[model samples]
Target chain A: MPFSLLNLKALMPEIFLVIVASVMVLLDRAVREKAFFFWMALVGTVVAWLLARESLDLHFGASYLSDHYGFFFKTIFLLVLFLTILISPGYAKREGFHFGEYYGLLFFAVCGMMLMASGTDLLVIYLGLELMSLSIYVLVAMAAGDPRSIEGSLKYFLLGSLASAFLVMGLAVLYGKTGKIVLSELAGWLTSDKAVLTGILFFIVAFGFKVAMVPFHMWAPDAYEGAPTPVTAFMSVAAKAAGFAALGRIFLLAFYPAYAYWVKLLIPFAVLTMFVGNILAVVQTNIKRMLAYSSVAHAGYILLGIVSGTKEGLSASMLYLLIYAFMNIGAFATVVLMQREGRVGESIFDYQGLAKLYPVPAFLMLLFMFSLTGIPPTAGFIGKFYLFRSVVHAGYPIIAILAVLASVIAAYPYLRIVMLMYMREPEREIKLAPSPYIWLALGLSALGVITIGIYPGSLLTSVLASVF
Target chain B: MEKVLFGYLALAILLSALFAIFSRNVVRSVLWLLVLFLHQSVLFLTLQAEFLAAIQIIVYAGAVLVLFLFVVYLINLREEIRLPKFLGSYPLAFIAVLSMLILAVAGLVGFVPAKTVGSLSPGAILKVGHTQILGEHLFREHILAFEIAGVLLLVAVLGAVVLVRRLREGEL
Candidate 1:
């Protein structure tokens, strides 16, 4: 491979993150105060973000690209990572698990997600996925003494490793059948190969596992509920977005010629994922578990766009994923704020009379809840509109209607939170440990959600234009 | 001679794999696994892949077996071996295994290696040497993957440290 200066410059964000994370890893051992590492992590993320902003336009190499599509997802990952770090220290402090590895692992996970977004080769994408998955496995298990955390982490590890196995197996089959590695070049050989067609099943199940589609979604809620709150927030947004990013690129680029076949395979999964996620979310009392199921449902909606197999559908999914990062981080930020002295404070009943006490966060949670349920005046509605419109435009009116129904069913859980916060009497006096950084993140997220909800025209046009 | 050696290696591998899975004693299973690894390395040797054969023996037989022996030695052996014996999923496992075995047999029966055209042929490997060819591929076309693997391993090390965090506290 020609190791070009241009390629390294294109990868400046990833390189910057590696250096920063390594420094922090060394500094973490020497630094006595966890707060010091936290500040270092924040500084590193800011520097990485600046590098990422410049790196977006630097495109080359046979394996990876630095185009608008990757750039869009990278920005979302960095924003989510920044917010996750901001919201993390408070909960880590409460859990007595505040340390350097948490932030270092988180940053590395962000790097992995960025790589996944940018990689064009199947090998690069797979390696990126593993790197990200490994970091998250460690981060999920970071709360050592907590059995829930360990259990969640273990479950995630087993299922995640299996998912990776499926992906590798599929990629191997594709390579064996077609002898091509780069996704763009595979389409010509892949269109005529039967074994490569079989390989497509592995890709579906593998990506489905990553995005938590229904049959493969069993591990998600346990992992989500049991993980540390900040990690939960990060995984629900950035990690899920990473899954869709790979899915969109691989299926769109490599399998575009075979779209008709994959679309048929994807439609039922979209419906099942949405229905199961929403219906199961209804009975969940824990906030994290509810969000896990809700995230699954959102993944289903995003898949609705991919299933259409058109640029319009693809653009719609891209736009929805960006909007999702803001709303999810907003909700989880409130969940972080609701934490008491010792616990993560995840039970829905914990939010009773929340409006009377922490009115600002309570109101923000309401906005997030509304956005999540596709109510107007929040970003989720506009996202849902474009996604379903594209699906219907692609001639799948029934799936769109079923999606509308699933969102309607999904409203119950979000509204239930709203009810507990606003209408119900206080079950007990809940003490909140407020972190200023978390508040800033929550404010920014709420602003993002509302601003995009109302004026999505410019962003929508750009997303549509740049997707090719 | 190569065919005869391949036959012996394949038989040894199959038997050892079966014994490794079915053996009740944990140490016995590890010994069977060692046999499987040895046979695999010999198969590679027969294929003229000397580098792979050497690495396979060194890594799998030497280093990995030592680690496995250490873990089996440290843990409660009898209790670990006696805990469970394929309880509920036996029938389902049987069905799945049978179908997969049939599929494997059919696939092998139908297998035909695709003939390469102007690519890395055996003559090319004999001339250029396997290690150099492997290095060229790794450093050239797959360099990005090579670098990413380093990142993956670094993450794993960090992960191991994280997992072992409360080891001093008797949590493990």
Candidate 2:
């Protein structure tokens, strides 16, 4: 193959991420300032977003499509990355972990996610998954002073390696069956034989682990609680988005024929994930652990869309991911800002009387909580509505009903946070410094949540057009 | 001769894979992985997939395994730590392994009878099905994916650099 600059242009987003991550790592050593790293990562993410947007004009054939679906998810990933970087400075300063390496690792991870979003080949997708997972393991262990972080890192590493092995084995089986590894070829092969069905099941299992569906979710709470707040936020939103993106492509293309076989399997797991996640969250005192369970519930909702087995279902999943990115990141940003003297207060009691002590953050946290609970006038509500509607449309009314029940159960914990913040008296006086970057992120996310809730038609139309 | 050679290679691969998974020592496991990788490359060669065989050697056996070995050495697994008594249920592990072996053997027994042994001249195999042919197909049919793989590799390289970058005190 003759390498051309034109070919490089096709990889603008990826190139941008790589360059930014490289520069960030180099500048971390040269600058000796933490704030600079944060701003650099933020700017890098924005630049990558712009490059990703530009690449939409150059969509190729089935083997490498860069359509609206990829761009939409990439945009969501970039937004999540920006918010994570925005809230990171405070957490990094407090935890004494403000290194350029941190931001660089994040950039590379995001780059991997974007690649996964656009990938049309199984090999490319696998490579992207590995890239993302490898960086995340390092990020989880980056907090050197915390034993919990090390433990979390080790656990995540072990489970993630197992998941990778499963995924690679699935790929091997699929390739052996079809003598092809490209998505287009696999789609064609799906129509021919039933043996590929087993391979597809293995792929779905791998994705289930990545998304923390019920039986595969044991590692999530510990990992979420142990990692720094910003990293947790990044993992919950960006990592989940990448996993869903890859899973969506595989289901919609390679495993379309086997949907009948697996949708039944997924429905039960989705129900269990939602039920267990919400019930567990209700008992959690640690804010991070609660959010972890909430994330598991959100994964369940996303899986509900996958079970719908229609273009509409896939579109709803994508829309839900956008809203999830905002809500999860905003929630974590508040957590990061709430830290005092290099330590985050994770217990629900730490938030007692916060409404009076820190009104802005308190209010923002309330908005995020409401959004997560899927209340009206929030993105979460709209996301859930679309997801349920799609599932019902696919003749899964019982599943839709169960989902609503789960959401109602889930809302109790989200509202509990709000009640603790606004309705309770202060145990002690607290001093809070408001960071402008975090405020910006919170405001944007809140606005996004509200706007999408009010008028979701446009986003829905775009999502439907992309998926179909 | 070709069939015998291929059978020997397949046996080597299966044996090495079993050793890699079941070995007590990490170093021995890595060695078994190296052996399996080498056997895989030979299988690629038998199929006249010279480019893939070369890639198997250079990328998997050479670069990736070397990196794995380096990390293993850096960690310096002390016997006390590495040989810690099995904390999980050994009986369960044994049962799982047994079930896996049974399933694998059953699947192979079912598949081997249906396999077609295609015969071609050595000249035809080398000339039409070598590195050049693979390159042509990769460049022509799968060009976009090929480019994407390049970008992915570059990102990984950059990511590794970022992960290992040093941080000074008070410098986030």
Candidate 3:
């Protein structure tokens, strides 16, 4: 085939992201200050975002798409990536992990998420998943000599590769039934034939693993607790978003005709994920592990949107994801900034009297925690409201009520952090001197949560417009 | 003649796969895997899938087996090899395997794959040469996937480098 501009136009954003990642790696050296990569990555991601915006309607044949759906997802990824890079430099410097590889691998992960969101074919999706997973595995282990880092990456990698195996096996089964690898083709195959139960089961298990749902969530707390803070923040938002993107496309788009079977399959898993994630989060002393379980619970809430299997449901998941990127990243930014002077302030006690020490960051952390707990006047509230409202509207009111119950239980831990930050006294004088970039990351995330919370109408309109 | 050869190949593959799973020694298990891969290639050849047969031999038997061997050599497996832990409780394992086989076959019994053949027929592919025809599809219709594959490889390369590269000058 000729190299048509039309065909390649849709891939411009992904191509640009990868190019930027490569350029960053090459430019990782020559600059003495490793933080320079952060600035460069930020600039490059913004440019890629602009490029993505331009191709919002260009669906490139069967293998890729650049529609508003993908464009919205790519925008979410870039948002997460931007904030991650903004906070990474300071965190890396503090943790003795100031390496060039960290910034480059982060961009590599961003590139992979972009591809996964844009991909219309299973092969492309699978490749993108691995690319992201590979980069993340390395990024998790970046603190080379740290025993926790090594242990975490090992557990994450082994389980991650097994999930990859399951995913490929699932794809093989689907292909065997239809002899096609494109997502669009499967729609026709399933609509005409019996739904392949084994194939769909594998997909659920694989995606379940990636999104850290229960029974497949054994790796998450350890990996999150042990990974460098910024890395954890990046994966919690972006990696999970990519997994949900794949799940939305594969199930909602391709296997949509067999929704009955899959929705029945998902409802129980959703309830279990919600209960396990929320209940487990409350008992955690380590803030990182608590957030990891919180992420799992958040994932369960998002799965509520998926379970409804309506267009509104899919967009609700996307909106929740958008709000989640800002709120969760903002929460982690505070933790990342607190890792100053070689003291990893990961324990819940570390936050005692944070308001007295650093009023601005403490306030920002409180705002994010509120958003996470789905309190009113926060984006998290709007996100969860829309998710459960849509699920209820879709005739799953019981699940929605159960979800609300889970959220109430989830509120206790988040509020506990607030109590520590505001009411309790510090054991020792905790030092927190966040860099300018950390401030910027925290400020932007805080602003995002507030702006979206006050007026979700505009963003919700756009999100609804993007759904197929 | 082809039928008889296919039967022989299938039997060899089955036997080698079982032995590979049950083998006491890792090295011997790898050898069994090689036999299985070789038989698979032969079976592919019998099915008129020449390109797949070649890939089965080249990529699986040649490249992947070598990588497996390298891994075996890289780690200390002597203790593991001497452990004699070849999945104990033979009766239960045998029953489990038999049941899985039965269920799998049962599930697949009436399932017929819809014909979604690529641009070239097997006969035409034979005439055009395996590599060339395969290259055409890979580069033409699936070119986007091809580029993505290139990106995957690049990520893998960077990952390997990041894992091994020492950031600071060390006393070691």
Candidate 4:
């Protein structure tokens, strides 16, 4: 219980992000150049990544963790942050938004997320959640021109506040029952008591809302559609990844005793979320809304991995989250580039016959779409394969069957987007002046998806090792 | 006498919490929240957590709720502010409260079965040796957690600064 600077050093990645965010905010005010904020965010994230890698060399044990799992997630979060900054510059410039505050808020949010991934105590986790949520509410409303953005911000704030209240209530009840706030201590208490089941249920509801699972997913589409494309990409990937990380930690550490309780509760929600998300996505014409529903389905798949309740299940969920970041960011990056004159091209009709006029951009979009649909030789396919295999291995063959069926049903909208690009005749000629950074993001994501699909041995081995 | 005083304080806390949740006006709700927070600090004091009580009052009631009030006032000028209606769900709320009361009673009853052992006196803190007992526990056992709490408070201060400063910049 001795206080040591070594403990502080273990949190270097989060500390670095906080420092960068502060500096970015100062630089944004001092310098008028917009590109500076973007580059600063990117460089800051890379430095954070290096710091996280360094932290992985430290010892990990109960109550305090520093290890491969945290390192892996920190890297993924940094990569997502880098891509978010890359795609944001053009959108920020076109929209006449204050660039520095945007990146500053982003870095702050990333810091919260990194802390959430690294936090060992329930109190720290709750604080991290609030930190992330507060920053994102501002980011969602950052674009002043859109009335929808304001509405989305209000809705997200209200609903997110409600979720936070539920989480706090759960924590309070758990603390009152056990006189402990650290997850390890709580887990020890849970072994002897069934009364803590109510607290666990409330915690599940809180996390379910954060991840946008079926019954709690009402606010997602509006929020996703209303935010700027880059912000949407960041929220979809980074926010959800952090949520999953926290969820995994809670289940593995605190709620392991009540696994039977949650497992029963989650199965129905997982199936419903998958079925509803896919069915809804099939009817959506708006690109953003479609992606939103797809996100819901992906949440179900992640939940499916959780329901398996094994170390393999947890590792597979992490892999799926990693792959999900690349596919989602690539998809949204293409969408961001398609914006012209501050108007993001969000309609499915707007994408029609894009291949004829903008071959390379359209092709890249096709690659993203294919990857999202879990086509062979893509990270998405491998991600789903690991998730399904884990579930089946855990004796949930029926869940895996439903998951495959849902994925097949979900592929329709993704393929439809690809078909619209490749097969349709042009109604209006479109020209996309590509940015090198955008191309760099897309190419990197595409290459990652394909490379991981072909040989997932190293990543899988590392992920498996981290879990055990 | 102490038991009666503690009972009155607990009742006040419960009433304020109810008022905070059910008040129609946002301003009234915030005021009730402040009262409830103050009562919470008193409870912390009763538990001999003086440091925590101070933080409870300063951070939650004094600083954070003031920010909430400020934001509420700033946004009050918006046209057609929708005051959230508490639908005809009073019955549900009543049922929830009733069930919680029943559960509390049940727990109290259950505690008696395990009470063959003599209970620790609530007034034992007045003993001279009790001060050392409390200090030893705080400094020796809970020291790491205590320091971490300090770090958390520092982070919270920084967060508040960032949020308020950003708002100022927006105004500029």
Candidate 5:
């Protein structure tokens, strides 16, 4: 185990993030201008993005890998971090919980996500997951005066700790059964033993909790609705993507021989997740809760790609997550825009007659809603198209059909938002908490959605190329 | 003799764990947890993981248990103990626990681990010293994760400060 300089260089992006976060913390005490911290975090993310691009394909010991797959996921995480920061300033100013630590915590979260993406060992991945979850728990509780925020953070923390416990227990069992914790080494112990099966089941439950599959998703909506709008957006995309990245790496690589067994185990959960998320979303009055459920449904759709267990299927999941970051965050950003003083803009009723008053923002919201529902010429549709195609290619047309039906059910809630905006008359005076940063985030998201939707070939090609 | 000692430690660990969970008094639960951690550490020692055994006692039994006792002291323990424990979901919880217990027993009955020993065998640990072996592995083999763990601790500290600090006027 020679400590090579190249291994250190491979970790440059994550190290850079840690440095920036520490600098932000120190600067926060001295600088009165909050925008300074924001600018610093923004610059830090851009630099880390560049570092990640430059350091791709480098390996750090046997425990950490910075291959194409990890690099691509890191790119997604940095994108999510960028969009989250862009959307945060406005909401933080409006809500009065904008601390320097918010930005720092976000950087730390992306750092953790990068670790999860690159970690080659189970222990490293688990630590990375914990880092991400702890930052998010604090972010969720940042608005300490809000009871909902406190409750949400408490629930997320307790349940998340339990999930981590399950993960540790799983790893212990796995280590005992196979005498291995590294993903590359675990493949050798693929015998159909009951102890190994139990270990794999624990891994499934742990990762299932991370990705919010079906029964494990109860914490999502409450946590989402209670957190700050930008934080919620970040959680829906970035956290879930990190989970899927680690889940894909561990299950597809480590458990390759038992692929059929786990895929069979996951299929029912995936179907249940889709139906539960979509059907429950239709009844939600709170906008955040609805999107939370929608995200859960999206998780099921993404899980379809993984359960397919083909290169094409995994790549489609990556593309789906990449596109989901845009459309989902865009939808949440619109909710942020609707945050006028004295009204949190959490209710679907808040959007009634929005198109009549603010046509531009309303149109943006409509585009996002359409994309979320998997309509054509939006990134969400392209994402779903490839996912279902991959599933079909993998000879699971039944699951694909079921997913499409679930998406149809998902459409009702997504489109209902659009319908409320365009058709209903104004019941009250609509006031928007307009900010330049939110507009930038929304515009970038819209641009991504439309560009990738129409001509997804380039992104698709890279996604396929990077399916390590 | 070694087998007998291992058996005693295992039974003690299980009994302490059960008592930790089912104890009505919060303070009593914390004490039971201490016993559980101590027994578990001895069990680790029997497995030839002396470093892990020491850590189990130092971290979990020492620091973590003390923290638990502090928390219990700060809270109104009488009210907490008076609350109905199961909240009417006893049957469902019982079924789930029973099934899981059965599954674990079934799995463990005929389980023989695959023979894939790593470099850190008992002989290797004895030659190099357990702590030295662990230090070399942590610092050289897994340095990236080690540094990341440091960052994780920093984030935890920062989170605690952010959550507890009072806000000033016009400060984000």
Candidate 6:
């Protein structure tokens, strides 16, 4: 309970974001220029990013820790927020739903993501998770004219509340079994007790639902497709990364003693997730839903790192998550760009012969598609390589092979888009939504993907160093 | 006296919960839910948790139930009542519920409550008072979480305004 200066400093960025977001909420009502909120959020994110620093000290009774691990995820969250805001104004304005609450909610969501990454206690992490989920539910329902948006939001809210209930139950059981909630302290109370296993299983289910692992991923496609493109992009990467952040920390720290048990339990789920996501993605006509499935598959890949139960594996997942934020958001940014007056650009066939006219977006989409397929010379390849190598190193060569097969199946849907863009003629005349900011966001993502794709050693080493 | 009150509260809770779920009239169902909430609060009171009892009444019975009533009022109650009371797949739902009940009972039957030593034990709660002890923890140890909850409420309000407001072009 002692609030030290250092602890206050550790929480500076989160506090700053909360303040800025609250002020923006006020400003949004008074200001006429919707673009003003965008600038505020953008500047706020930059400031928050600069304020973030790695502090190994655990603040507030081991509830929060500002460490390099959290710092890495925070950077990703900020990057996502920046990119999402960049791509949002045009879509929001075009769709006639431009509001300051949109940007404010995003800031709050990022603050939640930051807390999730940094929190070392179950209570804190749960609070963070709820904060993030609530913001996202509202964001998804922002398009008032679209019934699909409301449906998706409601679905997400219901399923998410169930998951939260499960998590609370798990936390209660764990607390009863151990009288502890802090990650480091919980390790000391490890037992082969049935209650502990039950609690752990509940936790796994909740995390699985959060990260969109198969069987628990029923809401992802519906929610992703129905949501605004920018929100979809934000949720797919930032929210999933937050889930994995907490998952990795809890498993590696609190449940490390029972790694063999949980790893075995998780492997099948991961394998199922990869196959379900990839195979289902192939049949999707909507680009957003396809990317939703693709994101689910990517979650399966990230789980390989945790399933390996190695520092290398954990860092590998972190690296993959960073790469994913870029390529996935980049893809969604393109979808946001494809939104014309009448066409929302939800269908994959809409991209046909796009290379003939809007060659730049077509090529950018091509780059993203290739990257998603884990093609070399892109960040996705580097990410997949590390994840596979780490899993193989952990002696799960079979899971690694299955992951590769899943990746192969994944190649078909992603490459099909590439082929469609270049080969088929446009079924109709395509006019893109005008957004200068989207280009900036897309360019940043492409740069991140290609730069890290080619020169991955530096990013990899930093990620390796950051792992807790 | 405590045992008698506890027995009555528990029975009332179960009966009201059943009534809430089975009532054909949606408003009547919500009213039954209010009864369930009231019984739950009395149960908490019997347990000597005055703060929880108060919160159960204020938050659940007072606030949440009222909100539920408002929502039910907004919708066409006659049409809702006319709609099928249950989905066609009730047998499947029954099976799922039965299995879950069995599993939960099985889990609980085998479980022995571990003696969790903490600063605020039952004896301490009686000495320090329930609300004060809770406030201390809320404002002291878990202050960050408390603050986060505040922000969450703010976002929830924002969400309500954003979703329900009329789309005004430029001048609102």
The deviation in Å at residue B169 for candidate 2 is: 6.4
Best-to-worst TM-score order: 5, 6, 1, 3, 2, 4
Evaluate model 4 with DockQ and give the value: 0.16
- What is the C-alpha lDDT profile of model 5 across A135-222, one tens digit per residue? 9999998766567787789888877888888888778888887888789989987777777778787777787778888888978888
Can you give the TM-score per candidate against the true fold? Answer: 0.92, 0.87, 0.91, 0.86, 0.95, 0.94
- Kept native contacts, fraction for each prediction: 0.44, 0.19, 0.51, 0.00, 0.63, 0.50
Clashes (backbone N, CA, C under 3 Å), per candidate, total 1, 2, 0, 0, 1, 0
Ranking by lDDT: 6, 5, 1, 3, 2, 4
**What TM-score would chain B receive for each of the candidates shown?**
0.86, 0.67, 0.70, 0.57, 0.79, 0.82
What's model 4's lDDT at A43?
80
lDDT per residue as tens, model 6, A24-71:
877876898877888888999999998886334446455788889999
User: How accurate locally, in lDDT, is each candidate?
Assistant: 0.85, 0.80, 0.85, 0.79, 0.87, 0.87
Of models 1 and 2, which has the larger lDDT?
A: 1
Candidate whose DockQ is highest: 5
Better of 2 and 3 by lDDT: 3
| Candidate 5 collision pairs | A98-B172
Candidate 6: clashing pairs of residues: none
Write the residue-wise lDDT of candidate 4 on A250-323 in tens digits. 88778888888779878999899999989899999989889999999999999987899999999999999999
TM-score head-to-head 1 vs 3, winner = 1
List ranges where model 4 is wrong by over 4 Å. Answer: A1-6, A59-63, A342-344, B1-26, B45-80, B83-172
lDDT of 5 by residue, B1-172 (tens): 9989988998998899899888877888889998888888888887777989999999998898898888888875753445334126888878977997797678677777645357555576678777887898788766766877888898888888788773324344
lDDT of 5 at A54: 89
lDDT, residue A124, model 2: 74
- What's model 6's lDDT at A284? 91
> Candidate 1 — which residues are off by over 4 angstroms?
A1-6, A341-344, B1-24, B81-114, B121-123, B166-172
- Native A-B contacts reproduced, model 6: 0.50
What are the iRMS values of all candidates? 3.5, 5.4, 3.2, 6.5, 2.9, 2.9
